[model samples]
Target: MLNKVLIIGRLTSDPTLRYLPSGTKVVEFGLAYNRRYTVGEQQREESHFFDVKAYGKMAEGLGARLSKGYMVIVEGRLVQDRWTDKDGKAQSRVRILAESIRVINKPRTEEAPEELSEEIPSEEVPPEGPFDMEDEIPF
Candidate 1:
C-alpha cells in the first residue's frame, strides 16, 4: 500500500518543540485550511483545523521559524496516537507526521509603519543572449 498527503494552510499558533527520551526532536503545531462553497444564493466558508508534527531536522527547522498566521505547505502521512487516561480509558488522536514543510508567508515585521524601507535595486541581466549549444558540454 502507498500512503501520502499534502496540505497547504495557515498556522494557528507557534510550533512547540520537544525531545523524546531517545533524543529525537519533535515539533507539533496546528494548521487551519479554509473551505469555500456556495449555498443557495450566497457564498459560505468554513475552516478545517489539523494537528501536525515534524521529526528530526524538519522538526528543528520549523520550530525555530514558524509562527502564528504563517502559511505553510506540508507533505506527510496520517498518524494515529493512543494512550490510556487517568481513569484507564484509551484515547486516540489523529495527526499528520510531516516529512517536509515549505513556508509560504513570513512573519510580520516589527518595524513601525513609517520605518518600512524600499527594496534595494538588483542588477538586471539581459536575456536572449546568443550561445552555441553543441559545444557546451562542460561537465
Candidate 2:
C-alpha cells in the first residue's frame, strides 16, 4: 500500500533535537495547516495540527533552522505509534515521519538583505563575521 503525504504549513513550536541511545539524532516538531472553504453563503476556516519527526542527517541539518512560525514543506509517510500507558491502557497516534523538508519562508529578521552591495554605501553595510546558524555550512 502507498502511504505518502505532502504538507505545507507553519511550525507551531521550535523543533526539539535529541539523540537516541544508539546515538542516532532525531528531531520532532509540530505543524499547523489552515483550511478555508465556502459552503453556499458561509465561509469557514480551520486549522489542523500534526506531529512530525525527522531522523539522522535530515534531523541534524534542520533542527536548528526550524522554529515556531517558520513555513516549510514536508514530504513523508504516515506512521502509527502504539504503546501501553502506565495504567495499562493502550495508546496510539498517527504521525508523520519526514523524509525531506523544504523551508518556504524565513522570518523577517532571519532573512538576508535582498539589495546588492552597490545599492548601499560601504559604511552603512553590516560587517561579515564568522559563519553562524544562517550559513549553509554543514554541521
RMSD of each: 16.5, 13.5
Tens digits of lDDT, candidate 1, 44-87: 99999999977676777777777887777877777666656777
How many steric clashes between backbone atoms does each model show?
A: 0, 0
lDDT of 1: 0.68
User: Model 2 over residues 1-55: C-alpha lDDT tens digits?
Assistant: 6878999898998898987666667678999999999999999999999999777
Please report, as a residue range, the 10-residue window in candidate 1 with the lowest summed lDDT. Answer: 118-127
Off by over 4 Å in 2: 108-139
Instruction: Give per-residue lDDT, candidate 2, residue 75.
Output: 81
Q: Highest lDDT among the candidates is held by which one?
A: 2
lDDT of each: 0.68, 0.70
For candidate 1, report its TM-score.
0.74
State the displacement of the C-alpha of residue 83, model 2, in Å, after optimal TM-score superposition: 0.3
